[model samples]
Target: MRRDNVSADTELEYNLRFFTQFIINPARTGAILPSSDKLCEFMTDLAGLGDVSTVIELGSGTGVITEKIMRKKAGSTTFFALEINPAFVDATKRKCPDAVVYQSSAENVMKHLEMHGESGCDRVISSLPWSTFNGETQQLILDSIYDVLKPGGVFLTYAYVLGVVAPASWRFKKKLYAKFDKVETSKIVWSNIPPAFIYICEKASR
Candidate 1:
């Protein structure tokens, strides 16, 4: 759905179409459909990133938001992007050359961290379509993210309107509540065609 009169770049426009056709439709990639620039900026602000040393983005399609993050990068922040789509991954690497791009799934982020001897990430920004995943896979991904997060690190995810994207049987809300110390949903971005909400979660203290 077209959201704004502001046109996306050629790369971003192509990525949006690719995500809609291959990821959101097939449900294989588990990536959310492309979000409007306004929505992406809103999510970034809600992440409350300050002095973030390492930032990881899951499902970095076409690097639309990845590019924005790189442009806004703080002095010490290093951005890492993990994507399951090979074409999109290659495009992201080329588009956001400053980011460390990984052609892999978010479920494997823990192993990636371990292999790289990385302890924890400061923030995680995700565009994975959690509604397409089963309960177990969703929990697994969330657990993996938690395992590699610094104390009080935040995770940001987007979902279509609450009732529509998140169903009761999906148990996403319940799992999130159980997994994180705090979870909050943002106001709907009505400016977007289909509208969406941002889910921000913070890891609890042990």
Candidate 2:
């Protein structure tokens, strides 16, 4: 029961922080509430993150998914949680001190990894707000992702059900199809505030 209480407290804290951040900058934070544990579970299961050696988490707000990933580690692995929000970065760092919490744009992921003597990631889980970025910005970020992900690596992110027909979301999906040979989607996670689904894109062999 102690563990359950702690989880509830963490969830509450995450929700408060996420709402404040979204109020400060909606485009940066995306949702008003932190991703629901239900969504995190679905994402972790679809990514099979426990099996990967190096994982990169883009836009890891409040470490919701980061917590899920760390809790299910099946092997030794490195994790980097990147976020542009200083508050979210600090909060996530406090919650997940083991991860390299980077307060930088995901576009800089390659440079940051190189600085740490790392080359590529086996899997990347993004919580970024793709529906807010322009096509050029989206391309730049996706290119960076491709550069850092090892061949056969997977890139996963979620889109709110309402975002499915948004112009930016539509374009982002098209970009994923162009870059990845295999793009798969998961069933909607109705438990989340706005309802969301996961996209699992596999990098093709060169």
lDDT top scorer: 2
Cα miss at 189, model 1 (Å)? 1.2
For model 2, residues 1-206, the per-residue Cα lDDT tens digits are: 12342476776777788899999999878888888878988898888876788888899888888877877655578777789999999888777777778899999999887876789888889989998999999999999998899989999999999878988899999999998879999999998989999999998877
Q: Quote the positional error of residue 47 for candidate 1 in Å.
A: 1.6
The candidate that achieves the highest TM-score relative to the unseen native structure: 2
* RMSD to the hidden true structure, all candidates: 3.5, 1.9
Give the per-residue lDDT of model 1 (tens digit) for 1-206.
Answer: 33232244754566566666564356755434456778878887777655788788898877767876776668678667888878778767766776788989898887776665678887899988777788888889889888778888899887767446356324877787788889898999987545888878898755
Q: After superposing candidate 2, which stretches have Cα over 4 Å from the reference?
A: 1-10
Where model 1 places Cα greater than 4 Å from the true spot, the runs are 1-25, 29-33, 162-170
The CA lDDT at 59 in model 1 is 88
Residue 32 in candidate 2 has what lDDT? 88
Q: What's the lDDT for all of these models?
A: 0.75, 0.86
